[model samples]
Target: MKKTKSYKFKEVDLVSLRELALKVKNQTGFRLRYGGLLTILRTNVEEKLVHTLVQFYDPSFRCFTFQDFQLVPTLEAYSYLLDSPIAEKTPFTGPGTSLTPLYLLERSNLKTTCQDTLEDILALLIYGLILFPNLDNFVDMNAIEIFHSKNPVPTLLADTYHAIHDRTLKGRGYIFCCVPLLYRWFISHLPSSFHDNSENWSYSQRIMALTPNEVVWLTPAAQCNGHFC
Candidate 1:
């Protein structure tokens, strides 16, 4: 029999991706598929913990959370965030760093239930990639003062995540973050798309609005924290 493609989240309902990861951790005492508790703790466990941290720091996390197969707060929210004056300045800099939503989340003390730190940083990095395509280059600019183009950043990010997944889990070359699989697992819970038209309607508009900085918006609260924890 042909085996169906599998994701980290699995096809189960009533369980968020984050909850699932935590469950895995609880059941096996670690996130890795194999033994070596310390190894799993270092990589997957740490990342999951960070996701929890960000959520705790930003109770108004709908902007980063997913909904109905799309991001929360809508693409419009992303537009508002980017169009804001702060987006133009260098992030992680004195004032500019303060402007980043990630920092805002960190300050809120929102509250999460995980034990890893590196994973949290990884999640934040991915979240940053989604929320700010030009996040890295806010200080210097050409005469045009335009942000460098990483158009279709979401697609590239997805590809990169997949590459990292294959390299780490399938190839054993390096450790990979579980967030991508975790995100995909959650996205699978959304209502399936109906129409087949590749380029038509608000759907595409909404997706284009995502940018790389907006993809994590694809993850949902249901997918992040089901009652399993």
Candidate 2:
């Protein structure tokens, strides 16, 4: 277990907070002071990560236009969308060019996560799809192990998420958390699923409403090519 200065630097929370402060201050000319600053601070922190991760790809995300969206999630609600009963958990070194959401979170015990703890860890798997259409040869390059020494961005994101996620007052379910929103965005662009539950008509309608990148991102052939997002 390495405890180098880099590890001790707490770069994850630091950078996340920095970004939160900047976002609140963005174009407002001055930071808005609120009586509920702490509550606002936590929201900013949570949304900052999600927004930063997806803004380039979706203006719906950049605008943060969802009405009922909350920054907190219940374990039951979070697991509903993320967990698969029969799926095999894939290690970072596990064979695959693309990392799916189930595989990434499957093995994580979620009891308590740490930067170097791969036996159990938490990660924001959304980056796998929204950030990279393809990891291409990520595992082959030996680029991401549990303890990512040179590139700890994944670990950082996971830790930052848990710090806020675990602490927020438990929310009703998946819709309360940002993860479901990200999934809603992704699925809006895909073909009808082989196993369709078709329950979220209103939510699906909202996601499919339209965005600047919708035309380009929804194009299956153009996914591999850049569409300015």
Candidate 3:
């Protein structure tokens, strides 16, 4: 996609269609596989506690709840949190750091779940790569962007998927993503209300040093109270 000094909001769907896809990190997708205690995470003390009302998108059952997954939202964030939070335990990166959708998901406690989502992500990648080659630049890693350009879409997707899947299964490194870049693509092509929720994504883009993408996921991460049914 072409970048302009300004973006057109009239063509954007910031509030409804793309919020879920744009806001919530890939962790929501991981819980679908593990179905265990999940920690509803927030970046700061000012954030809300979300354990109820809002639901997560599970690839298997679709939109499951805390009890359904047995998640444990932190009574408090980080220092205020209990147990060894893997999401926060990232040695390679920090909590609020923005990464590829795949990287965000890979940091999840549910590695297998993240791996499963990888296949779907690859599907999305193929679609984006074929129709919108610019999506390649927004990916989390150099190899992935290169992967999109290596061959025709159908063969490229297949070859890349198998190779990455094998690496993941064998505990090897694989491609990742950057969230803000993804948001740019979403805003330009897809219907997104990113402008409606700009404040929530402050620190997420800190390390990436890229333009801010639309975000509404901060509501649950930064506003909602945790609920266990």
Could you give candidate 2's per-residue lDDT for residues 150-210 as a string of tens digits?
2323332343344324332232112122333333333434344412436544333443344
Error of 2 at 151 (Å): 20
Candidate 1, residue 112: Cα displacement in angstroms equals 31
Could you tell me the TM-score of candidate 1?
0.19
Backbone clashes, candidate 3:
28
Count clashing residue pairs per candidate.
16, 0, 28
Q: Tell me each candidate's TM-score.
A: 0.19, 0.20, 0.19
Encode model 1's per-residue lDDT on 42-63: one tens digit a residue.
2232233223222311123322
Candidate 3 stretches with Cα past 4 Å from truth are 1-5, 8-86, 91-229
Model 1 regions more than 4 Å off: 1-147, 150-165, 168-187, 190-229
Better of 2 and 3 by TM-score: 2
Which residue pairs in model 2 clash with each other? none
lDDT of each: 0.30, 0.29, 0.28
RMSD of each: 18.3, 19.6, 19.6
lDDT of 3 by residue, 49-88 (tens): 1111111212233222222232212222111121212333
Q: After superposition, how far is residue 52 of candidate 3 from its true place, in Å?
A: 32
CA lDDT, candidate 3, residue 157 = 29
